[model samples]
Target chain A: MPLPSDIEKSFAASLLDKDGRVPSDLTSYSSPVPQSRFNIYRNNVHVALIDMMAAKFPIVLKLVGEEFFRGAARVYIRANPPTSAMTINYGKGFPGFLENFEHVQDVPYLADVARLEWLRMEAYNAADRKSLGGEDLAAIDHDRLIETSFELHPSLRLLQSEYPVYSIWQANIDGVALSSVDLNSGGEDVLIIRPRLEVLVIKLASGHCDFVRALGSGIALGEANERAFESHEGFDLQLAISGLIGCGAFTGFSK
Target chain B: MTNLSSWLDKPIPARAGVGLKPEHFAEILDTEPDIGWFEVHAENYMGDGGPPHHFLSLIRERYPLSIHGVGLSIGGEGALDAEHLKRLKTVVDRYSPGLFSEHLAWSTHGDIFYSDLLPLPYNEATLETVVAHIDQVQDVVGRQMLLENPATYVTFKSSDMAEIDFLREIVARTGCGLLLDVNNVYVAGTNHDYSPQAYLDAFPFEHVGEIHLAGHAEARDDAGARVLIDAHDRALVDDVWALYERVISSGVSVPTLIEWDNDVPSWARLFSEAQKADRILKGAQTEDAVAV
Candidate 1:
């Protein structure tokens, strides 16, 4: 005789598939409710997960509008339900989904905005470490400071997007009119970090992103500065160091 | 990480608590609500660290907490997700919560995790799977887990036992406790055309470690009969409260929680809901005192 788990196997298999039929044999033959009894599970799974995605990606929802966002979200959810039980970490693929979704091609920047939103959510919950401040750097001897390799804060996330992604995301976050984001203005290098409680989303200066990227790659500060200066004009080493330290970007450094 | 060695084993009192939310974090710290205790989804604090940790650590010092696991999927067929289990252990260690509980429903299959709690048929194989899964969870977290009965819309033909009997057997086999969700009893009863009182009557109240109360949304089945969805989006209805009062009248002073997961109301409103459960709990306590 087929074991109960074997019977449940058929029921569980089609539980979340959009096109799969519910295991009808398992339900009450005479359900007082006239509908397919299995539809309840279908509706519950779709609605709850879709709502979760909507909450996590509010900016994406705003850009696409509620109806449009929900529709796309439903498709995305059915195709890609959460892999892990930790749902707070769900929807990491939504940005990529939006990028490939044909209907939203007109709103190209929407995908990057979604990325920025995902990174912010990550920063909001990432592990905490004591962040470096200018004072901490000032206490270091000049020679040692230049040679010492810096550590990126645990919550730091850097994104180099080919859209005015930061401008679009900021506009939405502030509830400012979308008109404020002039997409024609070009792309942005966005830096996100939560040194303590508040998550900061920063638009970096010219070549500063290169400097941070170099440091993130385990490059020493002096070498990181050299790489930044070689890439872009007027990449001030002092300005970059001060800017990063001021925003609590790096943790303690080792010489 | 918290100082586990110095941790006090504070159990939940027979009073009402509310599910904690982020929007009310500041308000909760600013003006500590006079609620019994607070319950939070274990997954919410699974991340490495952030405001969730900062706020939870502070709140833990003041109030008793119950770590409710919504995603553990005790009823899952597959071996529980190892990564998710580690995350759960992290949360459990960080907060030596007064109580820990998970659903009777499964939320994962294969590699895919369904966020909603899905139903399961009662049978020998499932019963064995559930019992074994609960034992593993208890060993890993080093604590007892209260299994909450699910709100179901349908029953199975492959079932060999009643829901309460399945629960009774699980408790007997694994030494696990129960978390009786009053709202779920009402909702599941109405959905399956069963009697809520009968279900509660058969409940192993002695094994109940805690209680949950939430408001459900009403819908109609195809035949237009009432189907209650365990929505947890609004205030507890009067019928559910009446059932709760019945539980209280049975001389069980279990710690109760008012759970509002979606469309969460203001801290004051949610606190008032907790206060309502507290009133019922208090009324029963006073009557017991007089009889004694």
Candidate 2:
């Protein structure tokens, strides 16, 4: 006897295909046209899930034309089937899938573009935080700053990639003219943080990439600054600090 | 009893409502639309305390809320998912939705959840399974849940029951009300080559406590056949609205919600759809009162 889980998995898989065969173990009845009935239910379920994916990853779909995206999506669905009952976050690992997908490897930046899109979704759904301003950061004394850890804003997301992800996203967005983007251009380190109500993806100063990343990973100012100097010599402390502060990336400082 | 009754029954005002998508959370809180209520997927709020709770609490203060579940899988052959039921119970108690509804389909078996609402054959075996599942859900949630009809693409050769008969039987067996999704009726009727109006005529309107209207998509089959895919929330297609008019004219004046789950539009656009429903319901009410 097939376990219920296996039966359900097979049923879902059947929906994504034309066979529409329910797991043979599910039925003992000598019913003809079982496949036909299953086909109807299968189509509804398959299309529903596809529609869900399309809604969740619109930019990704737009970036890779619809026909290719849907074809790739059906494959992704079968491989990394949803784990959570809340299908809203079902395609969380899609970026990674696109990165390693053999067919999409030609578009080296496609995966990074997908990551950017995913971050956009994450920032959109992330908890709303009262983003602090320059006034809030000024209150922290320099003597205490070294010992203090900064809390990234609730919607703050760091997407560092070896490709020009922002430009790739920009080129595909609706109404934006399609242009030949040079893939060989040196990589960009993007800070995808919602400083206020709107989520913004600003390119980072090469030197401050390590600094913001360390701070985002819960490092104190003194330690993150040291890491920043080690990674990129002469990393500008004043520029990075002022930029982070101005963007409302730091919600609060921990003494 | 006061709390339970209050919990189970909140005044469902005849106004338009929007499916509470994550995209519009901040907007909904910032610019509170004159929406009658907000509906959410019960499964989405199944998580432990976080943003969903934070925003939902804020929205609940200003608008009546409804919990529309997509994963209960009420018509499956397997036993009702106990853990899923418990999670649902937690959300229901937390929000106390004015109306709680789930689709009349199944989506899981033990650890494997398909994450899609798959239909059941309308037969004796399926009927028994549906009744058992409904009883289980009601027992866990402490209220009668409404089961929305499924939009089907195919029929079973061995199925002895009609879709209407199957629903009427479930209503009788479990005492749960029906959530008449007119768009679903139209989609299924057209897909299966049946009259949408005929399905509505057979629907037990007296037992219906809610109505759903949403948009759909079209797909071509392998044999070059065009099939209607019920892509919820693109727009309120003309056929669905026409079906709604027919349903309300038949005197089923429940708290109707305009569900737009995918490609959700702006708050104004969503509320406008709700406004359309509100207008029709209002016209129906005035005509009824004048006649009486």
Candidate 3:
């Protein structure tokens, strides 16, 4: 008789391989077809994991259609089984999986869309905190403000992609009328945050993206604005600051 | 000891309650149905703070709550995951659910997690592993947990014991209670060609802390034999209802739960199912009173 760990290892391996045989130690009451009965478990595991991925990446499923999405998801799940029992945390590798997926090469933008969806899920579940307001920013002295670095909200996420992922995500998820997007219209940068309870995706100017990315990494205000100005020709510090504040991106600050 | 005493003090009433789904949050809060208690999957509320916790807090204020965990994998061969246990402890401390329960089957091996409850061979070795796992869980959570019997489609040849004996021994060793899932009994009974009644008769219902009744899907096995899958996506079948009535009539009226996970129906439909179970519970109480 095999040890319990040996049986478990074999069972886990067999769940991913179709030609894998059921362990000889297993038996049914009436029939000798343990292999046939084992298919039920294999099918259950696959279907459950595939459904979890589908729920996590609905826009990815929508782009690939159900049949293709299921096929791709099966491949992804076989390669990367969940490490945690929480289904919500199951698809952390899915966006990367789509990038290397041979079948999805035609839709190069699919991976970014998956990334957007994953970010939205993260933002939705991120720790809740009271956001800072415009008045709070105004309360700071000018000299100290330059030396102060603001803390971004826990729910805030920044993304820069080589495609117009924001428009594509909106079109697919919101059921907006599909319109042709210019691939040559430069790369897009987006800021995702949950201000209240709803996750909001805001398109950011290149300069603002640079500024927020720097500040998010603990850079002081003056240095962050300098990097923003160097990145874009017309970087408006006041406009960027006000826009991020309105989106509830910052929580508090320290010198 | 103090924590355990506090947990034991708030016992869920012996009536019917439905699994709380996010879809019915508004209706439940608005109508305030006379539910016995509410049960939630512990994994669903592991997040820091969101709508899941927001609504659950309001609902918990009104009714007694039970945390039914599906991810603990207590029957696995290796040591239980420490991080998973810590998260579970956090939730347990936060909610202080009247009853905490997990399945008898394993869902993880090494780092790979199969979300569904997978079957285990019933033998001395496996029994020892499970008892130890339960002991570890109980020690960490600071309270006793109810171990639920699993619905199996396949049996192992290496098994040297019966399911009832395995459960009985688990309770004897670790001092844990049982969460008798009646639908699982019916499903496993039909799939394995055993008498559900006989299984129930041999079961040690004295250790039962809660009861679960759910729906199963009907399918044919490879040999063209009839089998039932514990789907939990539909209403309870007539046969399962009959078995539940049998359990109640036998003077084992525990806290019952109506589990509807997938293809969730409207608030009215789900509440009606609970109402049906509630009526049976009332009938059982009346019978006991008359006997007394």
What would the TM-scores of all predictions be? Answer: 0.96, 0.78, 0.97
- Clashing residue pairs in candidate 1, if any? A34-B223, A35-B222
Local lDDT at B257 for model 3: 99
lDDT of 2: 0.76
- Clashing residue pairs in all predictions, respectively, total 2, 2, 0
Worst 10 residues of 3 chain A by lDDT: A177-186
Which DockQ values do the candidates obtain, in the order shown? 0.65, 0.15, 0.71
Summarize candidate 3's per-residue lDDT along A167-248 as a digit string, tens digits.
8887877797546666566679899999787889999876888999999999989999998998797999999999999999
**Judged by lDDT, which candidate is best?**
3
The candidate that wins on TM-score is 3
Candidate 2 chain B worst ten-residue window by lDDT: B1-10
What local lDDT score does residue A33 receive in model 3, on the 0 to 100 scale? 62
TM-score of 1: 0.96
Off by over 4 Å in 3: none
For model 1 the local lDDT of residue A174 reads: 89
Q: lDDT: which is higher, 1 or 2?
A: 1
Q: Write the per-residue lDDT of candidate 2 for residues A1-255, one digit (tens) a residue.
A: 343345445665675554666655333122323444455566555566676677777877887788888888878876766654656577888889998999897887878877887887677667666767787777888788887888887777777788877667776664565466676777887777765446677778877778877887889999999888888887899999888877777777785
> After superposing the true interface residues, what Cα RMSD does each candidate give?
2.3, 6.5, 1.4
- For residues B1-292, write the lDDT of model 1, one tens digit per residue: 2223423476788899999999998999999878889999998898889999999999999999999998987887779887788789889888888888999999887778878888887878889999999989988887788899999877776677889999999999998889999999999888877889888988889999899999999877666678788989999899899999998899788999999998999999999888888998999999999999
Ranking of all candidate structures by their TM-score, best first: 3, 1, 2
